[model samples]
Target: MPRIVLHDYFRSSASYRVRIALNLKGLAYDQHPVSLVAGEQQSPEYKALNPQGFVPMVEIDGERVTQSLAIFDRLDALVEEPPFVPSDPPGRAHVLALALTVACDIHPLNNLRVLRYLKTELGQPQEAVDAWYRHWVVEGLAALEALAAPQAGTFLYGDQLSMADICLVPQLYNGRRFDVPMDAYPTLLRAEAATLALAPVEAAHPDRQETAQ
Candidate 1:
């Protein structure tokens, strides 16, 4: 096995997703912290490795990979146990839909850069920015709650752990951090609770990371 180096921030949800996948696959890796708040991601050297200029940049035996979803797929392909993605087509689509609801719809809206733009560039107060965060979180989670309420069992999409579960646990963590109203999403909460109980998921929590501050 080759050395895996993960360039990540402790609290980044994207990085958290990859951490869960790596832990679930039982792959050990070294973590190099990239402080998103300190602007370490924008340094020219890191940008050369990941033009996206974000955490969760994975270096496998010196080869680089970016994007959480792509990394998850690659891990699934590399380590053959407990597929991170679903095996069936419809199952895969449904899981990806749920995952994207967090990745594309909810996360980008509330990430550090966007919120910083709201506060610094637009001259919005922290309260206004928090309101903005809550708005998008509520909107996206509402739809996800509906989609998940029907299918949720021990995890999203029934008892088996899938990409949906992997994506969701981190989002719920973010929701808690922002104090998003979550009572309406009972099914999502249930699945989140179950997912967090897994040893790998617990180990991947942001607070447990080496760089957590």
Candidate 2:
């Protein structure tokens, strides 16, 4: 096994998810923090590694892997101990659908770059930007609530921790950080609490990271 390096930001939801996956798989890796706020991700050197200039880029043995979902998939293939996705096609699709609902629909709309664009380019007020963030989180989480019966199970899909739980935990972290009210989503909140109690997830928390302010 070669050395693995995780290039990520502490508060980044995508990075957080990858951290959980790596820890869950019991993989050892050095964390190289890229300060997204300080604009280090856009630097010439970092951009050379990742053209998209995104956080959560994993460098394994010399090869670079981008995208959170892809990284988790590769990790699953490499280490079969704790599976990342379901084995069956339907089960896999179901888990990925839930994961993508948060990663694609909710996260993109409220990420740092988009929020900055709203504030800097569009000149949106803080109140309006916050509203925008909350609106999307609530919308996406409502659908997730409908999809999951978390009270019956420890995780999003079930007893087994799947990609959906990995994805949902970070989204909940972001939601709470933004002070978005999640009272209406009981299943989501319950699942969030349960998921975070796991040692890997707890270790991967944003506040526990070295870059945390």
Please count the clashing residue pairs in each candidate, in the order shown: 0, 0
Clashing pairs in 2: none
lDDT per residue as tens, model 2, 86-144 = 78887788888889999998999999999999999999999999999999999999988
Over the stretch 50-151, how does candidate 1's per-residue lDDT look in tens digits? 898988988888888899998888888788888976788888898889898989999999999999999999999999999999999899999998987777
lDDT at 210, model 2: 90
Instruction: State the weakest 10-residue window (summed lDDT) of model 1.
Output: 148-157
RMSD of every candidate to native, in Å, equals 1.0, 1.4
Models 1 onward score TM values of: 0.97, 0.96
- Model 1 TM-score (2 dp): 0.97
Q: What do the candidate models score in CA lDDT, each in turn?
A: 0.89, 0.89
Residue 193 miss distance in model 1 (angstroms): 1.0
